[model samples]
Target: MSATTRPSWTWTIEPPDGWLVVPSTATEPADAVRAWESEVVEALLESFLPEGATGPDAPDPDADHVATVRGSLTQTVGSLVTFADEAATEGARAMAGVGLLDRGPVPVLVTVGMGDPDESDDVFMTVLGAKGGNPVSPPSIEYPDLPDGDGIKVSRVDIDEATGGAWVSVAAGRRTEFPDGVVDTALVWRSQDLVLVPTILDAIVDLLPAVKIIRSTV
Candidate 1:
C-alpha cells in the first residue's frame, strides 16, 4: 500500500511584465500540477516583496500555516467574489481609499497570521500587494478567526529585517497582542495588522493587473 500527501498551491496569475511563477514541489509532479491553479494560487503577489523577502513563505510553510493562508485568502476572495457575484450587496462598493496611488480601484492585499512562524515570538504573517490611496484601508474581507487559537499575550519591539538590497525592508514587526488574549470578543484582536497592510497592498498593485470589486452604490 502507498500513502499520499496534499499539493502545495492551487492558483496562479501572470502580470504584463512577466510571469510571477509558483511551483508546488513534490515527488509527484502531476499531483503538484493538479493541486495548484496557475492563476490564483500562483498569484503574482509572491513576486511583490521587499527586496530581501522570499516567496512561498518559508517562515511557516507547514500544514497549519498553509491552511491558515489558504483559508484566509479564500475568505477574502470569497467575500469579494460574492459581492462580485451579486451587484446588490450593501456597502459593497469598492473604494480606492487610503492607498499609495490616487485612489482609483485598489491593489488587493492578502495577509495570514499564525502563532510564532519560524520560531519567532510573534504571530507571523506574509503580505502581498501595495496600497491604492491611503494604503491603510481595511481589506475587502478579513480572515476567519480560529476558535481558541493560540494567542501571545505580550507586546514586543518592532524590528527591521531588510536584507534584500535595492528595495527597503517593508516587512518588519514586533510582538502584537490585544489587551485580552480571547480573540472572538476582542475588538482590537488584529489592531497591529494596521501597520503591516501597506506592504501587502503594494505587492498586490505591482503584481495583479486588475482587481474587480463590485460597487453596491453604483
Candidate 2:
C-alpha cells in the first residue's frame, strides 16, 4: 500500500535477535490471545468502511475480518509469551497478547499486547495500578515522533519482587488522530544479573523503532 493509503490493520515490532519464538501450546494466555484476535477483527472491519459509509452501504466486513484475524492467529499465536503471575498480568492480558523470550539463560516473559483502543499512557497506568509496583524511573517516557504514528507514550515501573529476575513492566502506544486507533505495549525484563539489564534495554529500544504498520487493501 502507498504511504497515503491508511492501514486497515495495525502494527508490529521486530523482537530482538536470539529471541526465539515460543512454540504453540495450550497455555494460560490463550484466552488473552483469543480476545486480541477478536479485537483485531473488529478494528479491521471498522477500518474497511469508507470515511462516512456505514451500515448497509458498506458491505459486511465480517467475512474478510474473520479471514484476516484467523490468519493472524495461526501465524503468531504460538510465538506469544506471557507473565501471568506478574501483578500486571490481570491488566496486561486484557489489552494485548503476551509472550516469552527463550534466548537467554532465563526465560523473560513480556506483554506483547499492543494497539488497544486506548492511549498507551492510559493503558500503562491501568497495568501499573493492577500490578501495584514502585516506579522504576519516571512514570513515563515520551517520544515526540515514532516511526508510523504521530507520537508515542510509554509508562514503566519496576516490579517489587519477581522470582529470580529484575522485572519491569512497560506499557506504550503510538498516537493517531483517531481516538479509537490501536496503541502498543511491551513489558521488558531480564535476569537479575546487572550486566544483562543494559543489553535487554538496548534490545527493547531497538525493537520499538522497528515497529511497522502493515495496511491491508483487500
Which candidate's lDDT is highest? Answer: 2
Worst 10 residues of 2 by lDDT: 94-103
lDDT per residue as tens, model 1, 1-218: 12454212111133333322222222226454345433443352243323323345545435465555555544443343333223223211121112233221122222223232335332242221122222333224233322324221111223234632222123212223333221111111111344544544344333322221111211
lDDT of 2: 0.43
TM-score per candidate, in order?
0.22, 0.41
Name model 2 segments beyond 4 Å from true: 1-16, 27-120, 125-132, 136-145, 150-180, 209-211
Candidate 1 stretches with Cα past 4 Å from truth are: 1-38, 44-61, 88-218
Give RMSD (Å) of candidate 1 vs. truth.
20.4
Candidates in order have lDDT scores of: 0.29, 0.43
RMSD of each: 20.4, 17.5
lDDT of 1: 0.29
lDDT of 2 at 73: 50
Clashes of 2: 8
